[model samples]
Target: MATTAISADTSARPAAWPRALLLIGRVALGLVFVVAAYTKLHFNGAWHFSDYYFFFGMAINSYNMVPFWAVELMGRVLPWFEVALGLALISGIALRWVGIVASVLLLAFIGGMARAYVLGLEIVCGCFGNSEKLGPLTLARDGSLLVLALAVTVGAFLIKKRAERVRAVLAARQETVSS
Candidate 1:
Protein backbone atom coordinates (compact mmCIF):
# COMPACT_ATOMS: atom_id res chain seq x y z
CA MET A 1 0.00 0.00 0.00
CA ALA A 2 1.17 3.53 -0.84
CA THR A 3 0.55 6.53 1.44
CA THR A 4 0.02 10.01 -0.03
CA ALA A 5 0.32 13.34 1.80
CA ILE A 6 -2.22 16.12 1.31
CA SER A 7 -0.66 19.57 1.57
CA ALA A 8 -2.65 22.51 2.94
CA ASP A 9 -2.17 25.53 0.69
CA THR A 10 -3.92 28.89 0.81
CA SER A 11 -2.93 29.94 -2.70
CA ALA A 12 -6.40 29.15 -4.01
CA ARG A 13 -8.06 31.44 -1.48
CA PRO A 14 -9.44 34.80 -2.48
CA ALA A 15 -7.08 37.75 -2.53
CA ALA A 16 -6.91 40.27 0.30
CA TRP A 17 -7.26 43.35 -1.89
CA PRO A 18 -10.74 42.43 -3.00
CA ARG A 19 -11.78 42.05 0.61
CA ALA A 20 -10.24 45.43 1.40
CA LEU A 21 -12.15 47.06 -1.43
CA LEU A 22 -15.36 45.48 -0.26
CA LEU A 23 -14.77 46.81 3.24
CA ILE A 24 -14.10 50.26 1.88
CA GLY A 25 -17.20 50.17 -0.25
CA ARG A 26 -19.32 48.93 2.64
CA VAL A 27 -18.11 51.60 5.06
CA ALA A 28 -18.47 54.39 2.51
CA LEU A 29 -21.99 53.36 1.64
CA GLY A 30 -22.82 53.10 5.33
CA LEU A 31 -21.53 56.60 6.04
CA VAL A 32 -23.55 58.02 3.16
CA PHE A 33 -26.73 56.49 4.52
CA VAL A 34 -26.02 57.70 8.03
CA VAL A 35 -25.32 61.20 6.85
CA ALA A 36 -28.45 61.21 4.77
CA ALA A 37 -30.51 60.19 7.76
CA TYR A 38 -28.87 62.83 9.91
CA THR A 39 -29.61 65.51 7.38
CA LYS A 40 -33.25 64.59 7.27
CA LEU A 41 -33.55 64.54 11.05
CA HIS A 42 -31.39 67.55 11.81
CA PHE A 43 -33.24 70.62 13.05
CA ASN A 44 -31.03 73.03 11.11
CA GLY A 45 -30.70 75.09 14.29
CA ALA A 46 -34.41 74.80 14.98
CA TRP A 47 -35.71 73.03 18.08
CA HIS A 48 -38.86 71.49 16.74
CA PHE A 49 -38.87 67.86 15.58
CA SER A 50 -42.40 68.05 14.24
CA ASP A 51 -41.37 70.96 12.08
CA TYR A 52 -38.76 68.80 10.42
CA TYR A 53 -41.17 65.94 9.80
CA PHE A 54 -43.72 68.38 8.42
CA PHE A 55 -41.27 69.66 5.84
CA PHE A 56 -40.11 66.16 5.04
CA GLY A 57 -43.71 65.13 4.51
CA MET A 58 -44.18 68.04 2.15
CA ALA A 59 -41.25 66.85 0.11
CA ILE A 60 -42.80 63.37 -0.11
CA ASN A 61 -46.12 64.89 -1.00
CA SER A 62 -44.60 66.80 -3.89
CA TYR A 63 -44.16 63.59 -5.82
CA ASN A 64 -47.94 63.25 -5.94
CA MET A 65 -47.49 59.52 -6.19
CA VAL A 66 -48.74 58.36 -2.80
CA PRO A 67 -51.66 59.34 -0.62
CA PHE A 68 -51.38 61.66 2.35
CA TRP A 69 -51.41 58.78 4.82
CA ALA A 70 -48.59 56.95 3.13
CA VAL A 71 -46.60 60.16 2.87
CA GLU A 72 -47.03 60.73 6.58
CA LEU A 73 -45.99 57.20 7.43
CA MET A 74 -42.94 57.20 5.17
CA GLY A 75 -41.82 60.65 6.18
CA ARG A 76 -41.86 59.64 9.81
CA VAL A 77 -40.30 56.22 9.31
CA LEU A 78 -37.68 56.58 6.58
CA PRO A 79 -35.03 58.65 8.37
CA TRP A 80 -34.94 56.33 11.35
CA PHE A 81 -34.91 53.39 9.00
CA GLU A 82 -31.97 54.89 7.19
CA VAL A 83 -30.18 55.36 10.46
CA ALA A 84 -30.69 51.72 11.42
CA LEU A 85 -29.68 50.42 8.02
CA GLY A 86 -26.64 52.66 7.98
CA LEU A 87 -25.55 51.45 11.38
CA ALA A 88 -26.01 47.85 10.32
CA LEU A 89 -23.93 48.37 7.23
CA ILE A 90 -21.22 50.14 9.18
CA SER A 91 -21.11 47.38 11.75
CA GLY A 92 -20.66 44.78 8.99
CA ILE A 93 -23.59 42.87 10.37
CA ALA A 94 -25.66 40.64 8.10
CA LEU A 95 -24.13 42.41 5.12
CA ARG A 96 -25.68 40.26 2.41
CA TRP A 97 -29.24 41.05 3.45
CA VAL A 98 -28.38 44.63 4.30
CA GLY A 99 -26.83 45.14 0.90
CA ILE A 100 -29.91 43.78 -0.75
CA VAL A 101 -32.17 46.07 1.26
CA ALA A 102 -30.00 49.06 0.52
CA SER A 103 -29.98 48.29 -3.18
CA VAL A 104 -33.76 47.96 -3.27
CA LEU A 105 -34.19 51.22 -1.40
CA LEU A 106 -31.87 53.00 -3.78
CA LEU A 107 -33.75 51.61 -6.74
CA ALA A 108 -37.04 52.82 -5.36
CA PHE A 109 -35.57 56.27 -4.71
CA ILE A 110 -34.17 56.48 -8.22
CA GLY A 111 -37.47 55.43 -9.70
CA GLY A 112 -39.32 58.12 -7.77
CA MET A 113 -36.81 60.77 -8.74
CA ALA A 114 -37.01 59.77 -12.39
CA ARG A 115 -40.76 59.83 -12.35
CA ALA A 116 -40.89 63.27 -10.74
CA TYR A 117 -38.31 64.64 -13.15
CA VAL A 118 -39.95 63.18 -16.22
CA LEU A 119 -43.31 64.51 -15.18
CA GLY A 120 -41.72 67.90 -14.61
CA LEU A 121 -42.84 68.01 -11.02
CA GLU A 122 -40.61 70.54 -9.37
CA ILE A 123 -40.09 69.21 -5.88
CA VAL A 124 -37.49 68.94 -3.21
CA CYS A 125 -35.80 65.57 -3.35
CA GLY A 126 -36.32 64.90 0.36
CA CYS A 127 -33.26 62.71 0.10
CA PHE A 128 -30.85 64.35 2.48
CA GLY A 129 -33.39 66.97 3.35
CA ASN A 130 -36.10 69.24 2.03
CA SER A 131 -33.65 71.52 0.26
CA GLU A 132 -32.34 69.53 -2.65
CA LYS A 133 -34.29 69.89 -5.87
CA LEU A 134 -35.27 66.85 -7.86
CA GLY A 135 -33.18 67.17 -11.00
CA PRO A 136 -30.48 65.48 -13.01
CA LEU A 137 -28.09 65.72 -10.11
CA THR A 138 -30.34 63.87 -7.65
CA LEU A 139 -31.09 61.16 -10.16
CA ALA A 140 -27.44 60.77 -11.00
CA ARG A 141 -26.42 60.63 -7.35
CA ASP A 142 -29.02 58.00 -6.48
CA GLY A 143 -28.13 56.04 -9.60
CA SER A 144 -24.50 55.98 -8.53
CA LEU A 145 -25.51 54.83 -5.05
CA LEU A 146 -27.55 52.03 -6.56
CA VAL A 147 -24.52 50.93 -8.53
CA LEU A 148 -22.29 50.97 -5.47
CA ALA A 149 -24.83 49.01 -3.46
CA LEU A 150 -25.08 46.40 -6.18
CA ALA A 151 -21.31 46.07 -6.44
CA VAL A 152 -20.98 45.57 -2.72
CA THR A 153 -23.80 43.06 -2.73
CA VAL A 154 -22.26 41.02 -5.54
CA GLY A 155 -18.83 41.16 -3.95
CA ALA A 156 -20.18 40.02 -0.59
CA PHE A 157 -21.93 37.01 -2.10
CA LEU A 158 -18.87 36.08 -4.12
CA ILE A 159 -16.62 36.22 -1.10
CA LYS A 160 -19.08 34.15 0.90
CA LYS A 161 -19.23 31.50 -1.79
CA ARG A 162 -15.46 31.39 -2.12
CA ALA A 163 -15.10 30.96 1.59
CA GLU A 164 -17.59 28.11 1.52
CA ARG A 165 -15.68 26.37 -1.25
CA VAL A 166 -12.40 26.75 0.55
CA ARG A 167 -13.91 25.31 3.71
CA ALA A 168 -15.34 22.37 1.80
CA VAL A 169 -12.00 21.63 0.19
CA LEU A 170 -10.26 21.81 3.54
CA ALA A 171 -12.84 19.52 5.09
CA ALA A 172 -12.48 16.95 2.32
CA ARG A 173 -8.72 17.01 2.64
CA GLN A 174 -9.00 16.44 6.36
CA GLU A 175 -11.31 13.50 5.83
CA THR A 176 -8.94 11.96 3.32
CA VAL A 177 -5.99 12.38 5.69
CA SER A 178 -7.92 10.81 8.54
CA SER A 179 -8.99 7.85 6.45
Candidate 2:
Protein backbone atom coordinates (compact mmCIF):
# COMPACT_ATOMS: atom_id res chain seq x y z
CA MET A 1 0.00 0.00 0.00
CA ALA A 2 1.35 3.43 -0.97
CA THR A 3 0.83 6.21 1.57
CA THR A 4 0.56 9.92 0.87
CA ALA A 5 3.62 12.02 1.52
CA ILE A 6 3.81 14.37 4.50
CA SER A 7 5.23 17.65 3.32
CA ALA A 8 6.11 20.15 6.08
CA ASP A 9 9.49 21.47 4.97
CA THR A 10 10.97 19.48 7.82
CA SER A 11 14.28 19.59 6.00
CA ALA A 12 14.50 23.24 6.92
CA ARG A 13 15.55 23.71 10.52
CA PRO A 14 14.17 26.42 12.74
CA ALA A 15 16.38 29.37 13.41
CA ALA A 16 18.50 28.85 16.50
CA TRP A 17 19.13 32.53 17.15
CA PRO A 18 15.76 32.99 18.79
CA ARG A 19 16.40 30.11 21.19
CA ALA A 20 19.86 31.44 21.96
CA LEU A 21 18.39 34.85 22.63
CA LEU A 22 15.86 33.36 24.98
CA LEU A 23 18.64 31.74 26.95
CA ILE A 24 20.46 35.04 27.05
CA GLY A 25 17.38 36.84 28.30
CA ARG A 26 16.76 34.26 31.00
CA VAL A 27 20.33 34.45 32.24
CA ALA A 28 20.27 38.22 32.16
CA LEU A 29 17.11 38.41 34.21
CA GLY A 30 18.58 35.87 36.62
CA LEU A 31 21.68 37.98 36.99
CA VAL A 32 19.59 41.03 37.72
CA PHE A 33 17.79 39.23 40.51
CA VAL A 34 21.01 37.79 41.88
CA VAL A 35 22.71 41.17 42.04
CA ALA A 36 19.69 42.83 43.55
CA ALA A 37 19.35 40.11 46.13
CA TYR A 38 23.01 40.26 47.01
CA THR A 39 22.99 44.00 47.42
CA LYS A 40 19.84 43.89 49.49
CA LEU A 41 21.07 41.06 51.69
CA HIS A 42 24.62 42.29 52.20
CA PHE A 43 26.07 45.61 53.14
CA ASN A 44 28.39 47.21 50.58
CA GLY A 45 28.97 43.73 49.08
CA ALA A 46 31.34 42.88 51.92
CA TRP A 47 29.22 40.06 53.31
CA HIS A 48 28.86 41.94 56.58
CA PHE A 49 25.71 42.76 58.46
CA SER A 50 23.52 44.63 55.99
CA ASP A 51 21.04 47.35 56.76
CA TYR A 52 18.88 46.05 53.92
CA TYR A 53 16.13 44.81 56.20
CA PHE A 54 15.76 48.13 57.96
CA PHE A 55 16.46 50.32 54.97
CA PHE A 56 14.31 48.24 52.68
CA GLY A 57 11.53 48.38 55.21
CA MET A 58 11.81 52.11 55.13
CA ALA A 59 11.73 51.98 51.36
CA ILE A 60 8.59 49.91 51.33
CA ASN A 61 7.04 52.24 53.84
CA SER A 62 7.72 55.07 51.45
CA TYR A 63 5.61 53.27 48.88
CA ASN A 64 2.68 53.78 51.29
CA MET A 65 0.75 50.86 49.88
CA VAL A 66 1.93 48.30 52.35
CA PRO A 67 0.57 48.51 55.86
CA PHE A 68 3.02 49.11 58.66
CA TRP A 69 2.74 45.49 59.66
CA ALA A 70 3.48 44.14 56.17
CA VAL A 71 6.15 46.67 55.28
CA GLU A 72 8.77 45.05 57.44
CA LEU A 73 7.64 41.58 56.46
CA MET A 74 7.78 42.31 52.77
CA GLY A 75 11.17 43.93 53.14
CA ARG A 76 12.41 40.86 54.92
CA VAL A 77 10.94 38.37 52.47
CA LEU A 78 11.57 39.95 49.09
CA PRO A 79 15.31 39.53 49.02
CA TRP A 80 15.16 35.80 49.70
CA PHE A 81 12.49 35.40 47.12
CA GLU A 82 14.68 37.17 44.60
CA VAL A 83 17.56 34.87 45.36
CA ALA A 84 15.46 31.74 44.85
CA LEU A 85 13.94 32.97 41.64
CA GLY A 86 17.35 34.03 40.39
CA LEU A 87 18.80 30.61 41.03
CA ALA A 88 15.92 28.92 39.28
CA LEU A 89 16.26 31.06 36.20
CA ILE A 90 20.00 30.68 36.07
CA SER A 91 19.67 26.95 36.41
CA GLY A 92 17.26 26.86 33.49
CA ILE A 93 15.01 24.47 35.34
CA ALA A 94 11.73 25.93 34.09
CA LEU A 95 12.28 28.69 31.61
CA ARG A 96 8.67 29.34 30.69
CA TRP A 97 7.38 29.49 34.26
CA VAL A 98 10.37 31.44 35.46
CA GLY A 99 10.04 33.88 32.62
CA ILE A 100 6.42 34.40 33.54
CA VAL A 101 7.32 34.93 37.16
CA ALA A 102 10.07 37.35 36.26
CA SER A 103 7.69 39.26 34.03
CA VAL A 104 5.10 39.41 36.79
CA LEU A 105 7.71 40.66 39.26
CA LEU A 106 8.79 43.39 36.87
CA LEU A 107 5.18 44.37 36.33
CA ALA A 108 4.77 44.65 40.09
CA PHE A 109 7.81 46.90 40.30
CA ILE A 110 6.49 49.03 37.47
CA GLY A 111 3.15 49.35 39.18
CA GLY A 112 4.84 50.33 42.41
CA MET A 113 6.88 52.94 40.64
CA ALA A 114 3.81 54.29 38.87
CA ARG A 115 2.03 54.56 42.17
CA ALA A 116 4.89 56.51 43.69
CA TYR A 117 5.17 58.73 40.67
CA VAL A 118 1.47 59.53 40.66
CA LEU A 119 1.44 60.17 44.40
CA GLY A 120 4.46 62.43 44.04
CA LEU A 121 6.40 60.36 46.52
CA GLU A 122 10.13 61.03 46.36
CA ILE A 123 11.30 57.69 47.66
CA VAL A 124 14.25 55.51 46.80
CA CYS A 125 13.56 52.27 44.90
CA GLY A 126 16.16 50.43 46.96
CA CYS A 127 16.37 47.73 44.28
CA PHE A 128 20.12 47.31 44.12
CA GLY A 129 21.25 49.83 46.65
CA ASN A 130 20.05 53.15 47.98
CA SER A 131 19.24 55.37 45.06
CA GLU A 132 18.62 59.08 44.92
CA LYS A 133 14.87 58.74 44.35
CA LEU A 134 12.26 56.66 42.62
CA GLY A 135 11.56 58.49 39.40
CA PRO A 136 11.18 57.85 35.70
CA LEU A 137 14.45 55.97 35.52
CA THR A 138 13.26 53.38 37.99
CA LEU A 139 10.03 52.84 36.12
CA ALA A 140 11.86 52.64 32.83
CA ARG A 141 14.28 50.07 34.16
CA ASP A 142 11.49 47.85 35.42
CA GLY A 143 9.59 48.30 32.20
CA SER A 144 12.63 47.17 30.27
CA LEU A 145 12.93 44.10 32.41
CA LEU A 146 9.27 43.31 31.82
CA VAL A 147 9.85 43.48 28.12
CA LEU A 148 12.85 41.18 28.35
CA ALA A 149 11.02 38.50 30.29
CA LEU A 150 8.08 38.74 27.92
CA ALA A 151 10.38 38.08 25.03
CA VAL A 152 11.88 35.09 26.77
CA THR A 153 8.46 33.63 27.52
CA VAL A 154 7.29 34.10 23.96
CA GLY A 155 10.45 32.58 22.55
CA ALA A 156 10.14 29.55 24.74
CA PHE A 157 6.54 29.08 23.71
CA LEU A 158 7.43 29.28 20.03
CA ILE A 159 10.26 26.84 20.44
CA LYS A 160 7.93 24.41 22.15
CA LYS A 161 5.45 24.68 19.32
CA ARG A 162 8.17 24.14 16.80
CA ALA A 163 9.29 21.01 18.59
CA GLU A 164 5.74 19.70 18.62
CA ARG A 165 5.49 20.32 14.91
CA VAL A 166 8.63 18.34 14.29
CA ARG A 167 7.36 15.47 16.40
CA ALA A 168 4.07 15.52 14.51
CA VAL A 169 5.93 15.36 11.22
CA LEU A 170 7.99 12.42 12.43
CA ALA A 171 4.92 10.55 13.66
CA ALA A 172 3.14 11.10 10.41
CA ARG A 173 6.12 9.83 8.43
CA GLN A 174 6.37 6.79 10.66
CA GLU A 175 2.69 5.97 10.09
CA THR A 176 3.15 6.27 6.33
CA VAL A 177 6.19 3.99 6.33
CA SER A 178 4.42 1.32 8.37
CA SER A 179 1.35 1.37 6.19
lDDT of 2 by residue, 1-179 (tens): 12333553566667888778878988898999999888777765455344567877887788889788899898888888999999988888877888789888888888888988999988888787666478888788888888988898888788888889888887887887788
Ten consecutive residues with minimal summed lDDT in candidate 2? 1-10
Model 1, 52-111: lDDT tens digits are 678778888999989999999998888889999999988889999999999999999999
C-alpha RMSD by candidate, in order: 2.7, 2.4
Write down the TM-score for model 1.
0.91
Model 1 lDDT at residue 129:
72
lDDT of each: 0.86, 0.81
* RMSD from true fold, candidate 2: 2.4
Q: List the residue pairs that clash in candidate 1.
A: none
